[model samples]
Every structure is written in C-alpha cells, then in structure tokens.
Target: MLIQYRRDIADLQQRIRNRRLQTFGLFGTPIALVATVAAGVGSKVVFWLHTEMPNPIVNTFTASAFILIAASVVQFWAEIGGEVWDDSGTSVRDLKLDLALAEERHILEARRHTAPTADRQASYKERLPPEIVRLRMESRHYRRLHLLMQWLLFISSAAISAVTAWYDPPQPAKGVLIGLGFTVTVITAATGYFKPRERAFNLQQTADAIEQHATAIELGIAPYNAPEEARNLELFATTVEGMRADQRMREQQLDQPQQGQQQVI
Candidate 1:
C-alpha cells in the first residue's frame, strides 16, 4: 500500500510538471513570440505609416497594430493571473500529506511484521530511518533546483542587459530586448515568490527532527528509555505521529494565502 501511495504521488507530481510544460508550450512561448515580433516590427510599422504609406491605408494599419498590442497585453495579464498553469483542481499540499501517510503506514506494517520474535526486531529497527533519509534527499534535490533556477535567471538578465547597453541595438531590436527582459523578470519573480528554497528547508528540518527521535528510541536513550521493548515501541510510534503532525502544521502554514492575494483554486 505504501509503495502504491508513493507511485500515485509520483504520478501526480509528474502530471503537474507536464501540465506546466504544456502551459508554457501552448501559451507562454507563443505569447512571448508574438510580443517580441510586435515589438520588433513596431518602429518600422510606425515609420511606414507616417512617411511611406498612403493616407488611405493608415487607418487599417493602425487598427491592426492596436489589436495585436491589445491581445498581447491580455495574454500577459492572464499568465500573471495564473490562468495558464492552474493545478487542474488538486491541492499539492494534500497530495504531499497523503504520501507522508503512506510512508507512515509502511513503517507500521514493517513493525508488525517483525514483532513476533526478538531476532526479527532488526528488520523493524531498519525500516523508518531510510524513509527519513529519502525525505532529506528529496529536500536537497529541490534546494539544488531552486538555486540553479535563481542563477540561470540572474545570468540571463545580466547578459541581456549588458548586450543591449554595449552593442547599442537598433530601435526595433531594443523593443524586442525589452520585452524579453520583462518576460525573464516575470519568471524570476514568480519563482522567488513561490519560495521553493524555503519549502526544501522546512522538509529537511522535519526529516531531521524525526530521524533524531527515531535514533534516540533505537538507542534506548533519554525520553525513549522505557524499560520494556513494547513500551519503547509505543514511544516510537507516538514520536512518529507527533513528528508528522508538526510537519503537517508547517505545510499548512506554507499553504496559507498571502495578504491581499486570493488562492487560485
């Protein structure tokens, strides 16, 4: 059952990732391209209208330009409002909790399976720490990804700014660069605002706390130094429950809506 739960959570995460990619492919890239093209052609279009075009065609050209700009603005607003990558009616935090519950169930099963004999206690002892280790590793993975995205955005922004300043690009190219910069800024700001780094840190901290409690119980140390093996096992179970509760609280806090910002739902 725990394995099935893990698989389900993995599937859900993958679906979310794929949906985000699809959103980018269908809406993000095309809208950005349209905006860039409009920017690059804007100066020439204006020049042609004022100096080269016949007066009779000016109204039609102006109307077309206006429509393109208006459409681009609407697309940009939609992206900002999260219409492009909405989670398709699932709570990410709830999915994570479900995964955690699955892990807990697996641990309990391991304990029960090994409970019949003294010699088999080793199997039960070996069960939970590995799950904590996996959680820590997952947290580290997210931390690394968040850092990589931050660096990439920083480098891209700096490179774009430097090239524009040093090369003194034409007016149309300048407009395109400005649009690209705006897109990059939006991406960076969104990434930072979501705070993947903080999420990773919180996950790691919870794993560490759980692992410490488990270790103390295993070693027959303070707070878990119950005389009977059964009592110690009970302490271990309750410790895990308490740790999970703490973790859930932290996740709930993370999921809370920021002031003045309604949840996307």
Candidate 2:
C-alpha cells in the first residue's frame, strides 16, 4: 500500500511539473519575444510614426504589432493567474503524511517478522486504519490538485490561442506568432495526453469506494455483520484487499499510454 502511495505521489509531482512547464512556456516565451521586438525597433517605429507620412502598409503593420503585443500581455497575465492557483504545498504535505505512514508500516512489518507473535499481529491490525486514512486523503488531494491544473491549462491555452488569432500579427513578428501557436498546441496536447481530469475522477471514486467499505466494516453492516467477530474481521480484510486490487487495476489502466502516443512521464 505504501508502495502504491509512493507511486501516486510521484505521478502527482510529475503532473505538477508538467503544468508549471506549460505555464512558463505559454507565458514566458511570448513576453520575451515581444520585449525583444520592442527593444530593437521601438524607437524607430515611434520616430516613423511621428515624422514620416503615414502609409496604409505602415499603419497596418503598426496596428498589428501593438495588437500582438497586447495579446501577448494578456496571455502572460492568464498564465500567471493559473500559476498562482497551483498550490503544490498541499500535495507536498500529503506526500509527507504518506511517507510517515509508510515508515510506520515498515516498523510494524519488522516487528511482526521478528516476533511472529499474536500481539505483533494485533499491533499491525491496530495500525491499519491510520494507514488507510492516509492513503484515502492523499488520493483525494491528488485528485483535486490535478483537476485544478487540467482546467487551468485548458482555459489558458484556449484563451491565448483565440487572442493570438484575433491579433494576427504582421509579417515581421510572424515567427514569434507561429511559436506562440505551437506552444499553445503543445500545452493543449499535453493536457489531453495527461488526462488529469480523468485521473482525478478515478482517484476520487476509488477513495470513496475505500471509505465506504471501511465504514461499512466499522459499523458492522451487511457483509461485515457476522455473529463470529473473527469472521467479521476476515470479511473486512478481504473487502479492503478487493478494493485495493480494483484501485490498482484502475491505476494500471490509467498508466497505459494512449494509442500512438508515448507516456509523458
């Protein structure tokens, strides 16, 4: 179970890194290009505007350049807003809890191996609830964070692309504009390839299933309500194991790469 938790944490961290990279690429590159263009040609353009007679071509280029710059600025702002919402600390704390639970599980395993005693087995059982709780909580945290990132990436890409198209930058900045388009395309593709929303939904569903089974067992409800306490405990263990197995299957399916596309991480 701790091994599974570690995998989950690693997956979440990878997704976070991907999202940050997307945000940086989408926002930073365009801003830098715009700044470079402005620095290199700004004074000359301003002088031309003030001194030279305005021609249709010059007027069109000037308007297009300013519009492209404005669009880039807006795109940068949107990306920044998304980054602010991406609070990775929440997931980091969850990972810390998972590590602590893993350590406790290791200690219990060692004790049981050393003693092979009923008391040690009982101690191990006593530690199960907290470990399960930690797993469920971590899953839930990962789900929420991933969901947030998915939407952020989707909306930011869409908005930026639309703004870029509307601006339709002049020929001089065409390369930069093309680069922005490519960046948005990559970000969108990454979001779909990752399927963050699907991961979140699957994880949340698994967490809920685990919680329901655990709760039913604790309450001694049907399937776990037995005259023999030992039998009831056995059923509880079996149910939990089944739940974990199902979750692992779901995760495995998720881990499989999409057809014609390699896994990103």
Look at candidate 1 and tell me the lDDT of residue 73.
64
List model 2 lDDT by residue over 1-265, tens digit each. 5456556657666656655665665667677666666754665576664676347645655666677677666656655564543542234455456556665665676555575444443354566677566666766776676666656666756766666677666565566556656766775676666665666666567667767766776787888788876776666666666776876776676667775234433
TM-score of each: 0.49, 0.46
Instruction: Using TM-score, give the best candidate's number.
Output: 1
Clashing pairs in 2: none
lDDT of 1 by residue, 121-145 (tens): 4455567777788879978987988
lDDT (CA) for every model shown?
Answer: 0.68, 0.63
Query: Where's the lowest-lDDT run of ten residues in candidate 1?
Result: 256-265
Best by the lDDT measure: 1
lDDT, model 2, position 127: 64
Error of 2 at 265 (Å): 22
TM-score of 1: 0.49
